[model samples]
Target: MLEKEYDVIIIGAGVAGCVAALKLVANGKRVLLVEKLKKIGSHNSRKLDVTESQGIADITAELNLPFNGKFNRSIWYSPNANFELDSRVYDYYVLRGSDVDSFESIVSNRIKSFGGTVLTNAEITNYNFENEYVKSVVINYNNRHQVVNCKYLFFADGHHSKSLEIFGIKERPGPTFIGYGEICVNSELKAGVTHVFFDSKLAPGGYFYLGKADNGEVLSSIVINKALQGNISIKTYYQNFIAANANILKLLGKYKVKNSFVGMGKTGIISRRSLRNMALLGDAGRTMDPIFGYGVRQAIISGYMAAVSAIDCLNNKKRDLDEYEDKLNKSVFQGRETENQKFRNFIDHLNNEELDYAFKSIETIGLSTSLDDFFDNPFNNIGMLLNVTLKKPKLLTTVIIKFFLA
Candidate 1:
């Protein structure tokens, strides 16, 4: 069904967009959520994100929705199992995909149940603005363009948002990220844990992770830079990488892939979060934090914040939504960008041989550490540096020297 007007129009229905809509409608506002995809959730990336923050757990608990699992352990697996660090991780995991029990579906269904209208396979072809406020938006649906009136627009449509160029808005450019993932049934992986592999041959431009294998299903995903990977295709490389790993083979036993998905996006935050009454959240803004391997929690937090701010503005005659960016800066996004920079630098400075040595040093110390330190602060940890220096002096002489030189 189509409506003549809505109090707010939300673009995209991922975790961020859906949360925004849920909050708006729950606050007694009319919201129209439009998605170009035929459905709300990711195709088949179940247990796709293992977050390292408790911030997002609030939203699930608030909605009375249970998360998939709580991860208390993570292993930073080095090349060839030469060295690995099994450490403590304080975070929860969420299930993705179009399944009824998935986070995306649950949040989306809640919106509709609360009187929000969701139109899948819909695209915003054109829009009109009155002064600085949005007047109406044109959505292309069912092979026809339809117009609907709305006072505000919120776009959580990823880094390359559809609404950006239309308003002459400049976006913060970032790396082009491509990912491939799949889920298989009857796998032999233990739940409540995760593994991150950082080998160049295994995942050239990026890396791969295997975890959250539970209830007869396990998720496996790999990321790579095609140009960096050279002649081999990502699929071929991924297939071979998975099969060649003895640990993965042992875990697989006998299994069949049920569903596969391809994920593509641009990294970094949006340069302009709000233009007039339009605002961007999620990947459109800067919800993707690299250190944790995923940022669904951050995405959900950003969406909820955007929703609350918009509600206050729409209900109380406020019009300074540009301050949304400022709010984000003080909240979830605070200081993390710098950490992300350090993490990237650390990754860039390491290869297979150096990585093995670093993990070997960590293993020697018997430090039950959360990877957050390495990804969030790199080698800046004083105690860790001291221990590594005394335990693996050669690692400090070689890898540390190279890290500084780069």
Candidate 2:
């Protein structure tokens, strides 16, 4: 028998895990949140001064939670043009880069305030199963092994989750190497504008980004995609990019070094979302946009959805948890996961010259604007897609065929 039991057990106290805990408690369920790290939300992504997408705002309104995250106005600097996002798209705010650490702290405290249990430095080493359904989690806490039973389990442990394997789900595939690091600049960028650089030379398949906090601290980073055949190492790319990119160097006239890191992740979306009573959320589920690795909003959405599914399953309100995947595909992805996949495939087929040409065409056609402005009604702008197809008929056809075949 297990030492303790709860209505639900959520692993990984990141954004998704915390949201699941808080929401589950609000629905009158006992929740235990487990984090393997000593601290919550202290991951490498936090150090990058990233912005929260508009989906986060929707989650806040839906949940009526007191938590408010500050997001920043952003600018996309392509090889051919530079433009800022139009704020009129939705009620989005820019994240003051300095608030990364505090945001995690606030979420952690909110979970506790709502009577949700959170355990740091606690890891789920294994699980106890009954008839193929996970009945409880075997956790290692503070050097002691503990058995904690629960009706449902949430695996939000991120991109490299072992629980996914335990659940018999095949792993997703992606880039071979991802390198990210912070650089301080003497000069200040736009106060609220986050800048993204998309030149292949700088990051090849990935991109580079920079954002400044209200306090004037800037965090610059480079993510290298598919670094297997690269001549230079990931670190070399980072160092060379800083040294070679004049604009970036000029921006960093004088600055102090803070921290840097490199990691790998699977870029493909997960095929299996759940096995019996166990469900995957966030990176563990591979819900990122793939094109850009933007998952904060997706993470929040997955957590909220998973919590609802868990509650419904435990209460017999739903026959099974299969609805969780269906709901996510319909609601969060808006039935456009295939389109996004096609976009990724199309991008993969392009060379540097083609990429530059595409960006140039976007600027020439007056389509260049804030990221939000374009994505606000992306598909509605069929003219843009048609225009691109007209420019590169062969590539567009291949992308479409691949999507259809898949």
Candidate 3:
């Protein structure tokens, strides 16, 4: 029914696509950002009521693109134990059931401020490529089919992205999980701290988080491992979780469930390359390190990097997209691979004895040990484990040394 052409066509108007459009537009390129949904940020974007603190604030600040918003500090809790981290590490926690329109409005305003056009309710049916380069895309919007040509295409369409499949990209298998969350208003809980309850019974290999949003609403979520192969409903899981964790239920006693969100996907380590003319960003690029499950920051960073690489290729008139590979290697690939391997190993060998010893080590050495120092550098963790094993031989010997030591 309609046809148009632009310098770039971005599929999926979530954070990654929006960020890419913003960067591309800032670079003086005309972009056609399309979304299959009726509105932007309706999928995983809507599911997020709170943004977790990532190392991005510093990185973005360095790039002179600091997010213009207020952040509230919060806590993180381990699901399997009573361990509670009282650190102010997170940047902000969104309240449950916050206004999706308001969030989209902010993002839309930012995109417009950067001179980008957003197209919602536009579902891309397929892509047209020639000589290993993207040429155009066939789309359906409002009961009509159309084709839009573009010089470049960027896919940020979440985990099971349809765009990637059209471009001949496949995702590697990895661990997965099913998760659900809700936002409650007018609760008795404090307005700043996030509470996590680690209950294996309710979440299995996953955990739950309860936090106060910037607007003083409560957001709670339950993440469960899909590897367990159970047919338990999210509603049932929430009920069981509430029954076990009285403190959370008590705080949320009178608050109505304003919004319920559910997501089912692979949450573990999945590997895929993004080097073609049509680049893949965000969850489509890699899915790993669900420990924090902060795909937003990853999406933003990857989108920025992809745009930069694409710009370089265009300016240099180089058909080879090797720089994108290098950027991903440095920023995502290697780090993600290592993190995923480490997590898999850790989870495989984790048991009561090992956990007890690890906790004891934490108690003795304190939490000052940097995450990098312990995980990245194998020798540091080995030394700590050796110390614990020597003192508590009974507890340490039962654990797998190779798993944690590496």
Provide TM-scores for the models.
Answer: 0.87, 0.82, 0.83
Per TM-score, the best of the predicted structures is: 1
Q: Of models 1 and 2, which has the larger lDDT?
A: 1
Ranked by TM-score, top first: 1, 3, 2
Clashes of 1: 0
Candidate 1, clashing residue pairs? none
What TM-score does model 2 achieve against the real structure? Answer: 0.82
How would you order the candidates by lDDT, starting with the best? 1, 2, 3
Q: Write one digit per residue (lDDT tens) for candidate 3, span 1-406.
A: 2337877788877666766777777788777788887766666434444454454565455434433234444333333334334444455432211244344445555676776777778888877878878788888878888888887788878777765556555554556767787867787777655665555466666667776665655667787667653787877887788887677787666787667788765543334445467777777766335554533566667777777877887787765556766776676555666566566545534554455455556544445455434544657677765764578766655555646674
Q: Could you tell me the lDDT of residue 372 within candidate 3?
A: 34
Model 2 weakest 10-residue run by lDDT? 89-98
* lDDT of each residue in 1-406, candidate 2, tens digit only: 2239888888887667877887898888988988888777656443533535455666687665333234455556666656555454332222212243444566667777878888888888888888888888788997889988888888898877886678777754644447666645455565556667776676776777776665455767777566432677777777777676677766556677665655555556557787777888877887776666643667778898888888888788553578688777866677666577666655555555566555655554455444445556656667775775577777556546655654
Error of 1 at 72 (Å): 1.8
Stretches off by above 4 angstroms in model 1 are: 42-47, 80-89, 225-227, 291-293, 368-384, 390-406
Q: lDDT for each of the candidates?
A: 0.72, 0.67, 0.63
